[model samples]
Target: MARARSEERRAEILRAALEVIAERGYRGASLASVAERVGLTQQGLLHHFPTKEALLIAVLEERDQWDTGGAGLSREAWRLDLLEPLVEYNAMRPGIVQTFSALLGESVSDGHPAKDFFTERYATVRGGMGAALRAEFGNRLPGGLTPEQAAPLLVAVMDGLQYQWLLDPESVDMPGAFRDFLGLLRGAGDGPRG
Candidate 1:
């Protein structure tokens, strides 16, 4: 029972931290603010997460878990066709997407605590994308690019689409745009319809 309460408190802290991070990018967010949101002192928060970085890592992992349906994804679970639905799902959760985008943008600058994490994450994602593309399209896609060449493009488009959608939700039909992109990957003429 005590362990359940501890876990519940930790979950509460993470939820509070997510809101803080969404409103204020990782670098702009502070332990004090997150602690206050959870009705704890900074020192008390430290008892759950020894450092701000630890909390950030926990938050990121939790976000991924949510994205992957909490099943703890394996590489084989990734598929090119699944991206459209993922983008659509993301559209429903602006706060989580905003936090991830803010952190990703901030992490590009040097010395950010999340820099290393984002770097590693991109590498892993790119590799997985490459594998998924190869599995679906063989060594090369219909567009004449090798799966290796296309993986980064795929990652870039998805992330880029998220940025555009976040910036102008009214003008950007993100999932549709992504489906159009997939059409381009397959071949033209089947361009984005509506």
Candidate 2:
């Protein structure tokens, strides 16, 4: 019972942290703000997460778990077809997406705690995406580029679409745009090469 209660409290804190991070980018969010949201004092919050960096990492991991349907970030979990549903799912969760975007933007700064995590994550994602593309399209895509070459562009489009959608949800149809991108992938090679 005690352990369950502790786990519940930790989850509450993580949710609060996400809200705070979404409202204020990771660089702007403070531990006190997150603790207050969860009805805990800073000291109490430290019992679960010793440092702001630790809390940030936990929040990121929790978000990944949710995205992966609690399967975590397995390479096998990502596929070309699965990406559309993921984007659609993201469209329904603005707050989570906002929080992720905020952290990602701030993570590029020197000495940022999340820089390594994002760097490593991108490498993994690129590899997974390349594998997925290979599985679906064989050696080269319609655009005459290998999966290795196209993987980064695919990641960019997905992330860039999120930023645009977050900035102007009324105007930006993220999932639709992503589907269009996939269509481009299929049809791009059909046209004559320059």
Candidate 3:
């Protein structure tokens, strides 16, 4: 029972931290602010997460869990076709998307705690995307590019669409745009080009 209570409180603190990070970015967010949101003192918060870096890692892991449907990490989890649905899902949860984008933007700075996480994550994601493309289109895609060659563009389009959608949801239909991109991928062989 005590363990359950502790787990519940930890979840609350993570949610609070997510919110604070979403609004302020990780660089601007403070441990005290996160603790205040969950009605705990800073010292009490440290009892759950020993350091701000620890809490940040937990928050990022939790976000990944949410994205992966709580199944933990699996190589087969992400595919080209599933990306549109993921974008649509992201559209419904602007706060989570905002938090992710904020962290991603801040992570490029030197010595950011999330820099290593994001770096490793992108490598994994790019490899996964390349495998997905190979599975769907064999070694080469319709545009005559190998899966390895095209994987980064796929990642870029997905993340780039998120940023555009976040900045102007009214103007950017992220899911729709992603679907259109998929269409382009599929029809790349049929079009004339320079």
Which pairs in model 2 have colliding backbones?
142-189
Residue pairs with clashing backbones, model 1: none
Candidate with better lDDT, 1 vs 3: 1
Error of 2 at 63 (Å): 1.7
For each candidate, what TM-score against the reference? Answer: 0.82, 0.81, 0.80
Candidate 3 on 24-98: residue-level lDDT in tens?
765666899999999999999999998787787788789877777785445676767677788888898776677
Candidate 1, superposed: residue stretches over 4 Å from native: 1-8, 19-33, 50-54, 71-74
lDDT of 2 by residue, 1-194 (tens): 99999999999999888878767765666899998898899999999999887788788889878877886767776778788899999898776677678778978999998789889989988988898899989999987889999899999998999999999999998988888888788874234222
Superpose all Cα atoms of candidate 2 onto the true structure and report the RMSD in Å to 1 decimal. 4.3
Evaluated against the true structure, the overall lDDT of model 2 is 0.84
2 or 3, which is superior by lDDT?
2
List the candidate numbers ranked by lDDT, top first.
Answer: 2, 1, 3
Task: List the global CA lDDT of all models.
Answer: 0.83, 0.84, 0.82
TM-score for predicted model 3 compared with the true structure: 0.80
